[model samples]
Target chain A: MTASASERLTLVARPLDRQVASLSALAIVLALVDAALPTPLPGVKPGLANIVTLLALYRLGFAAAVWVSLLRVLGAALLMGSMLTPGFFLSLAGALSSLMLLAPASRLSRRLFGPVSLSLIAAYGHIGGQLLLARLWLIPSDGILYFVPAFALAALITGTVNGLLAARLLRRWPSSKH
Target chain B: MRLIRPGDVAVFTLAALTCGLVVWACWTQSPARTLSIRQGGALWREVSLLHNARYHVAGPLGDTVVRVEDGRARIESDPSPRQYCVGQGWLEHAGQSAICLPNATSITLEGARAYDSLSF
Candidate 1:
């Protein structure tokens, strides 16, 4: 019985490890791609990698999704040589805020708030977190607040695009019903 | 049966409302012609937009000649290597500004505050 239990444990662990690994790798690649894309303003990106997080959230579970996001933030920071820098902190803050929003949002009935709404909320949370951090540590002036309108507008555009894409992808996702 | 659900519509409406509010804030806020000259982060002078005159302000590098004309101000000349501030031409709008980095002189057009300040 013990031997069989260990075997089952390994079976479950292997697939879970693989899922986390692939999801993290995919998110990292998307993050690097987003970095390569030209942006109109500093701290603005398409956040394409977030699609992977949303997928993991909707299909796999919130825990898996959080792991993917945390790994992606750490991995992207390491790859970009911004580890332990302000940039790393900003990414970490954004990812945490995204997860914070997603946690509560996940409890809502699936029919009323689907992937699109959740994704949009996560996106806004991400931007708002980074902005708050930047204000507290970097600028600390009313001048920095002036960029709120521009940043908010960017967040809305990017959030909508990401949310719609996530929604479409989730529809085709095999186990999305979970 | 709709691909776009009610949630999607709600999100879109919320985003549109926020954008509209931002646009309204920008549009309704009048451009204040109050121009302030600063040197090394200190306020050197405040020139009223009601009057049009030329004034010389001392800066880190040397002197900057500022001219206020018809509710607009410009750095007519500066001692900087490149007359970049002069090249900026004019500062007519409330949010416009011209800076001579080398000379450590800046002219900014400031208006009334839209809000008290953004809270963390």
Candidate 2:
């Protein structure tokens, strides 16, 4: 006997729901880690949550990836108690801009450079957005300069880590689960 | 994936170059010997520096005191709980600034004869 159309839809929907729930869980965990970790630089973050972003990009489409990214930023901000401050706005700008750049780049180059490359590109975009906001709004003068090196370093480290992790996940799960 | 894109390289280089320029500009600015302290949007005290010029800044959180001497500057404030600005040293250049978040205070050093006094 052949399965009905609605049955197949339900099958697909269940996996999608599971995937979204897992992604949300990953985001919350990363946010907690970010707040708890100790770093030498003030206002500098490791952005470990980006690994989830890479996973979402590989498994889901750009829309799903974007949703994950936005939810991560907003949820992290709320959890960190920086939701309404200038820092929150700055982070929001950076996260959105990075996602905007990463979504397109991931679609274009997901096959060649794969996860690692996409992660680096996204991290770079994140730093770029932060620097732009710092120059344009926060400090407005030389503030961009102060953050450039630190941001660059962060992009390199976080991108590489997230990229490698994503690559590992993709290798382990070749077929998209959701 | 790629080593770096041309645009990314260009932008990064530009940012680095701009930082160098700002550091240079800040280094060349004049030293200030007087400091003005403010609290709650009102001027609190203006102190004149003598020998040593080492200042201990204590005030309500986010209050700023700008100390200018010769072409140098030192800022003390309560800015937020991080206290990143308090840890910063003096600034004696056109593009150098120290901000205290807890105190909502900022100190910038401007060159005496520079074209842009308002640059920082």
Top TM-score prediction, candidate number: 1
TM-score of each: 0.66, 0.56
Interface RMSD of each: 2.5, 6.7
**B59-119, model 2: which lDDT tens digit per residue?**
5652344555554667644456776866776654444556665565555444344333344
TM-score of 1: 0.66
Pick by lDDT: which candidate is best? Answer: 1
Query: Mind giving the per-residue lDDT tens digits that candidate 1 earns over B26-85?
Result: 555555659999888889999898799998988778889999998899999999998999
- lDDT for position A84 in model 1: 93
lDDT of 1: 0.83
Maximum-DockQ candidate = 1
